[model samples]
Target: MDEQPGLSEQYRRVSAWPLFIALGLPIAEIGVLFGLVPIAIGGLLLFVGSIAGIVQESGYVERPWNLLAGLGGALVVLGAALALSQLPGFSPGAVLAALGSNGLVVRGVSIVVAGVIALGVGGAARFVEQEPI
Candidate 1:
């Protein structure tokens, strides 16, 4: 007869998924940036992968509040990015218009900033007390 895994073993297995997702997102994004994959396909993969990871990690498939918080975080990041693009000396439209532009650098910096923000949100989410239905 096969023995069942202990609680700690099960917890360890479950906890590893988020780390895989955190590492995978940057790799997927880099592949898109490097033209290794089509942008639409890469974006679709990332979107689906991210949502699945969020649902699995947060256990929020049946709990809408966590999903709402995640969506709100994404919107905040998007709004900040748009505002930054309009600031003096950082217009993305102008950056792309110039020949041999620093668009890659801008993109890299934004990715790093977004990653940091995501980590912050994830860390904070852990501290929130969830009430059972």
Candidate 2:
């Protein structure tokens, strides 16, 4: 195969990030629609990780920790709002029931959880930065 002219190292034509990114959202949605916890969690993890990876690979950031943390923070806020919006009232029993039976609550909670995970991962990644010699 002849190499393409002017295709330098900075030009990325192939990457695994897009594949996982494509798969993650639908998988998460499927889980949410069906009220499946594990699938939703897994899908969210894949989705967030892949997003950070793709962003870094595309040269948007030398380190994606800040990006992931920002995303996580946004998710947490949005999820809380969504969950609260779906609530009927503030009764503890009602909340518990909603968590168990309500799809919207489940979706909101899942998003919040995913966001926390992303935030933690991002915070942890920040400390693991490679120091140039």
Candidate 3:
């Protein structure tokens, strides 16, 4: 007979991904900004890690705590992005001025995209059926 891992063990294993993403990404971004590594490499790491964390957490749709952890990770990533965008000569207002009215369109689209992602995270936690252990 095959022995399955206990619930606590399973949870511990599954929870680590979100926790790492939520905590690690910002540190990595700061390191990048401090010139510890090439900006391209650090940016790529941040982007991939964020996507992986979100996708991994989506698998835990039945677990509210896991979803909440994912949301926290996403927020951390968003904060990092905002910070990066403000660096040196990349201010949003300056870019928006260059783009004229099209900047408003871009901002509106981004808001809609963020809303959809938020809905997915919250809706999955509330609506998805948990599998029996």
Which prediction has the highest lDDT against the true structure?
2
Candidate 3 lDDT score at position 35: 35
Q: What is the C-alpha RMSD of each candidate to the true structure, in Å?
A: 8.8, 3.7, 10.2
Candidate 3 backbone collisions, by pair: none
How many residue pairs clash in each candidate at the backbone level?
A: 0, 0, 0
Q: Write the per-residue lDDT of candidate 3 for residues 32-124, one digit (tens) a residue.
A: 454333342344344444555566566744344354445544644564455445444555676455334443333332323343454455556
Residues 77-108 of candidate 1: C-alpha lDDT, one tens digit per residue: 65346445544565556644531344444443
TM-score order, best first, reads 2, 1, 3
Model 3 segments more than 4 A misplaced: 1-62, 65-100
Q: By TM-score, who's the top model here? A: 2
Give the per-residue Cα lDDT of candidate 3 at 126. Answer: 51
On lDDT, who's better, 1 or 2? Answer: 2
Evaluation by TM-score, superior candidate among 1 and 3: 1
Clashing residue pairs for model 1:
none
Per-residue lDDT of model 2, residues 1-133, tens digit only: 2487666755756988999999998998787677687787678778878898899989888877888888888878877777788896656577668997777888878888888988988988788877752
